[model samples]
Target: MSVESVVAAPVAKKVPVEREHHGDVFIDEYEWLREKQDPEVLAHLAAENAYTEAQTAHLQGLREKIFDEIKSRTQETDLSVPLRIGDYWYYSRSFEGKQYGASCRCPIDAEAVGIDAWTPPQLEVGAEIPGEEVLLDVNALAEGHEFISIGTVAPSRDGQLLAYSFDVLGDERYTLRFKDLRTGELLADEIVGTTGGATWSHDGTHVFYQTVNEAWRPDTVWRHRLGTERAEDVKVFHEPDERYWVGISTTRSEKYLIIGLHSKITSEQWLLDSATPEGEFQVILPRREGVEYSVEHAVIGGEDRFLILHNDVVDGVKAENFVLCEAPVADPSRMTQLIGHSDDVRLEDIDAFRDYLVLSYRREALPRVAVWPLTESGYGERRELDFDLELFSAGAGSSPEWEQPTLRIGLTSFLTPMRIYDYVPATGALLLRKEAPVLGGYDPDEYVQQRDWAIAGDGTRIPISLVWKKDAVAEGPKPLLLYGYGSYESPIDPYFSVARLSLLERGMVYAVAHVRGGGEMGRLWYEQGKLLSKKNTFTDFIDCARHLIDTGVTAADRMVADGGSAGGLLMGAVANMAPELFRGILTSVPFVDPLTSILDEDLPLTVIEWDEWGNPVADKEVYEYIKSYSPYENVAAKDYPAILAITGLNDTRVLYVEPAKWVAKLRDTKTGDSQLLLKTEMSAGHGGVSGRYEKWKEIAFEFAWLLDTVGLSGE
Candidate 1:
């Protein structure tokens, strides 16, 4: 018997709740959905799941087929290029039918040193390499847990102690544990509620990690000794201000332990000498309101220096574009410009090493990597790695050593699979390490990738990247999946997706709307799309969709919009503002209740988010502005497009209640009968399902629905 035969669609009971802010009142009818512990809430969620399953029952075959296509195109068993750190070459391998990968490392002998060390040792997909020590087998850790996430696994300086953190549920809170490599046994030490990473001291006796507050914000840094109980861990540093979160990391040079406290607009760093495990942390440049910067320890001309990538003015000149400067480590305020600010380049980050410095930046709306050679006289020539592809992403890979000459970089494009290469800066040669294996005879030349622009509402140009099979369409409108996430300064860079081929092969064009809120253009681009200028993000996406229609790329009736998290907020806003523009909308863990969420300082990460979305609770003006655009608050009684809202039961980032309440209101208020579905992942969190196989199924479910909505579900 079919599972859907006995289950029926849910009808949520509406209980009006009046929420007041700034002399204004909001009557939220579906507020009862927020009662997560209520029996009715669970029943409603289950009913919704059952209804979604019933409605899409016919797509089951298609979903499995799509999942199979994804599996077939991807190598079931694969091993990553081994990265050398200290005396070991570390790599991870996935086995066929396993949900997780196994982390392994092999010892480095004399033959595997020097230039050859830069190149990764190639191993067959399912073959066992000699002298490989199993560091952490995630598949074993995930044996019984329905949802298991290996947060961060970092080995100590001597590579004898392994500090790893894992989350059994979807909640971001992870439990950190230690393992002894020599004894091959789990240590007695364990720390709970960590944010998932540990920074080990140079001597490996103490490890620094961040712990979450009641609001789930990592607001405190604690240092733990190797053999002590977790309660004995010292609170090394605490960020009292709720607006800022704290993190700890060791510099690439292994010279200092940096405890960074930052919010959206402001940042402050405290540096502690790595050699002195028990020492005071000194502030490096006090926090400034608008100025933001990052520092890396470097040695140039036989003098100790700090490489600062900042938006601070030098002397009397203002640096609109972030400039690269060098300063004495003792006094970082006394700075001299090394790389002057340029309108063309947006300096992103600097990875400093003993031999050279690798800069990851963006130019012409594309990511670029450059190497600055170190010399006795001063810093030598700065060389930017060249790429032949029109639109691709290239950035530094896992080059962890301080004195390594060759840089490891990763490159990918819309049509190209991920490629790892070793760039020898001295010789100006890029040695190909490995290109991602696409098992079923995939060809990059069979597809097309393009970078197009659309004129936004305020005359600003927004970039849109498009990819589709070559013979899919030559003229007229066709099925197009327009994806966007224009918030949090997160750029949706072009990369290969094995699952996306299902859409492309089925005559669906995939497009990414690089709207203003993203970091694609520059700092100003993000500045314009946030806070008071936030509406530009929604209008920019609308303009991109209209541009697609105007250019005969796709018709409005054949288009579907997709975004998640902050982008899911974009999806809600655009759906409310322009319901007729899209045939359907796909939102994952949508943050639709922004006004309610940001106003409540108790929610996870809400206070820290005030910098991104202004503090609505204290300021009436900010309250009004956010309330005006908050998707859930702004939902009106109008015809709307078909919408599928997906959420995780344990999502701490954007609660499942946001989407649960959103769909209930939409079903009750929207005039159209276009399908409105909600699917809550019972055992997942912000990232949905944890395992690769389950995740692939979830992707197939969403993709199949998209194909069905766009009339491309037919064989």
Candidate 2:
């Protein structure tokens, strides 16, 4: 169980592959790892896993202790708040030993009406309801498979038929299946190779689904009759542009079927009446470069209209953060401004219902929700749902029913477990339905959550969210773990985690760096940290680390940095830029070889990413710009912090080879004797291990390494 037993790290065979782009040629010694099916590649990955296991064998007890702490804090047997759709109230339940949740529903009380009817039923855990029926038990489906993921669960308008999709492999593609809820039998109709979601026709005779192209982009929508064969399904819509991916969904009103086509920045929506299953779809707005819009069906002032949330130029002024407009159903081009754009607030989404419209937005770097009433007269004044917490996130939750008088809003913070509320618009009452159970008798007052700022090189103030146990920092400069994800306008909001308590109890501080490239501070924040300005993300993170050190929160030697996916790319970049700022770096499925990947058109999601990273293949400046900072290309023969890179063999988004090549290059080049390890999950995908227990183990593995690197492994 000693590190000495692991004789040496796995040496990846050097098979030089030349990649030339924009008159620039680069030799990649580990490019041969990209051959996923090759026996040699698999053997190398196995060897890497073996080496990682041996190097960390002594931490087995620590990992198990963390995992057990997570398990004990979580309520194993629980049921979700049942949502009323039609004649039934649907919910899911998880048993103590089950790896997956069971989808179930019970008949709604016909006697209840109005607000009473809209309220979600409070179901007890491990209790059976009268006339309850199990729709899909994922645990049963996952019995023989090492990994199983349920993608979409859609029931017919009448609640008699269920159409769902699941993936046995960790890959994104799924198989569509239908279940007869009344008979408790599965239909003979089965469709494979779909993107995992389906929209049903009003009459339940047909369902529309999407399939991916060669590059794993969902580009084609197909319509399948309930009793028809897969080959008989008609291709209803297809997007030929590789930059745009397509998806199909029905609005909450169930009045219109929408086919949404989107790239990084631009979007176009096609609409079809739900009543007509075989009708052609009409584009509400043609595809316009740099313009994005989403449509929702709304009945306003006794007239059918389409509420369009868009970022288009109005009166020669660009609505960069988006504005809401209403147009007649017959002519969507004639727009009437409803909600104008604001420089301070970014309007993210508007969900239209029969009684009201829910607005989800971001302001002051916190998520906010507002309700606007819709009556026969006109729209009422918007009411913002305010909370007392300054460092918390609040937004709309699951509200599937169109006529429901109550809106489901979820609120949480670093110290608060998720609390679900039913907001009654008419009375302005927030009814507390349920809060996620933390079974360890945890106290929110025992933890401290605060917001701090770091000054970037360009004078931008990047926000950092810090959370630690009240007693952990009394002695000053405790071990700190800094987490970051700054990409694709995706904001990592404040939320509660049960597993995080393990770190807090052990006297550790957890902080999140709200750097640019995220939508935390609004659209402009994202704009400043993407493409040519991506270096800002790395620099901003380093500045945040320095800020923590300067403020006496933690020293460089006591800090560890962690990020995953696009955030994983941040970890790699920062490790190369400022290795001295931390004792360890943990990256999951890191995009280290960006320049090489983006230059190859054959790679999955390369074309769609051009808007985010710039078209490196077609532009010499972009090629050189990416090569300058790409972790793999810039890795030097210098000392580095301890590094642990985790990846999945079936990850289609960030290929496993990216991290494999990254680790191989680091091991071969880096000067330090710091322990470098790569652990690839053989049966998982982008999200890692599928089962809850397995996922807990994965987190334990990472957290344990973090603790050990920060000199608190025994704790």
Candidate 3:
């Protein structure tokens, strides 16, 4: 199937809109594509979708084959490990033919105590369990909607009511609703345009949730009573700053409600006693630029305290990576350091429990979990949990009950399926609760996972994770698919994927470039790759690709690059900077017109992103710097690789117009006759689609394209 032999591509009409920022004037020809309500814009998007379908029609069989492979290897009829919350053991079940999971729970044994009481009930996948009650069947809720996303399924403290939210339009504005769990009937209270999560008050009379402002920043927290109208909900807190977002969550102990106000580089938390739903919230700490912190309620030495993970100064020295401190609940200003800051370790989160505190951090570019004992005297020794795999990810999972004796830890790697463990803090026992089933005679020994390093232009070493079938790569320089997401300090950790097996069995090598602008190597790595130094992310990725080729892992012609969202921005930058390094590029929801998007304060999430990408409107230097590297602005008349850009029509973040304009400009400017396609999900959002099966098909479509681009279609 020659892509070049397909019908002529859809040419988007050029309607120039001049944008001037910091005395710099630029003409955007495809700016008209941003209007979602315009019939012409919708028609163009439909035409582009038709063009993409016609071009990739030959790959439909292969897409189905890959999808079947994924389904065949996955345990379709499955149930997650039950988590104990209040009087019920809550879990979700997935059926073979179902698109969504069914939330279920069983009553806990009141007669049982200690280990027997805390241990989750082991329920079979298809077996009928005694006292099993279905909470929410998402499949039924998604009956009429083209797209449906379940946001929050929070149960009340007494387990009598459930507060859940759902989004049907894919714009991320959810409609919050209440359900009487005892009667299995929905209540009168309903709130619209929420940010998708609700925190229950201790007495179960009210729930606190957040709502987004015009800029799509969750800036207001509201408290809604169970039996009231939506308009009657009280505004608990509102963040006036556009750069900050607000979120509400109750402590694990259910003793306090925390309202966290955060920007990219700073944070301030407000705390209120959960016992009093109408009580005023007190500021735990004032927001300071460049200082970020998170608080967890803990009872130590028979006194209530706030466990704070912060990057604030200690003894006049800045704790950039962060340090753990404890302060009196009444006066949070008096802080006492519990764990000093470490330059090598990045403290990500801290969860407090009755017996211990779980510390989630990153060390040596890998996630690490540690348990600190809480005794009657004070804090005891801290023990770090160790895993055997060289390239794997391990973190604290859903252990919601504060008094539960065990910590749920989720572990996985490129070769290992997800394994959930209950870590006994008292005896230091790691009890394996469940391991995800992989059907069709799967074996981890058949695959190999390796960690390699590439030196950047500045002499900094970047880590690259490589995984492939041991036998498939014996011939050397096999077709490779390189994945990257280096933005927002988000790391692409090693994990097992059933869909990726389709690529590996087809003799393709998969590698992840843990470049800068990610949290893989700590805060310093992210700091180096963002704002003014953002180009380092693109160069680092290119260097990683070169290292792979130089080491005979894969040749340039056999390689295809993939990234989404901010990483899609990375893709656009790299395609313009080093188009010769890859045979093809696959970007989903690409932020190609970044400079223009950043310059517009009215766009969703643009104002809050100033800390990550500099404010081009205010800073002329930043304006020029971003324009110099922005992919849409840098599209040149040069031979480029086959490019496939995917986006969703209703996406609020990294709107669909960026990629539309990008592909349209690429078609006009690029010199090569290479395949350039844009596939837009007309009914979906930033996530592309809803439902597991639909998501799997989406992955299959992407995998098929990547395989075909790398000459592995016949495999």
Q: TM-score of every model?
A: 0.98, 0.99, 0.98
Better of 1 and 3 by lDDT: 3
Indicate the residue-level lDDT of 450 in model 3.
92
Off by over 4 Å in 3: 1-6
What overall lDDT, based on C-alpha atoms, would model 2 receive against the true structure? 0.92
Tell me the whole-model lDDT of each prediction, alpha carbons only: 0.89, 0.92, 0.91
Model 2: per-residue lDDT, tens digit, 1-715? 4555776999988989888887888999999999999999999999899899988888999999999999999999999888888899888889898788889899989899877888777788766688888898999999989999999989999988999999988898899999998888899999999999988998999999999989998999999999888889999999999999999989898888999999999999999999998999999899899999999998999899999999999889989999999999999999999989899899999998888999999998999999999878989989999889979999898888888888888999999999989899999999998999998799999899999999998898999999999976648787999999999999989999999999999999999999999889888899999999999999999999999999999999999999999898899999999999999998898889998888888889999999999998888898898998899998999899999999999999999999999999999999979999999999999989998998999999999989999989997
lDDT of 3 by residue, 397-423 (tens): 988888879999999999999999999
RMSD of 1: 1.4
Q: Which ten residues in a row have the lowest lDDT in candidate 1?
A: 1-10
What lDDT does candidate 1 reach at residue 573? Answer: 96
lDDT of 1: 0.89
Candidate 1: where are CA atoms >4 Å away? 1-3, 6-8, 314-320
Error of 1 at 90 (Å): 0.2
How displaced is residue 337 in candidate 2, in Å? 1.2
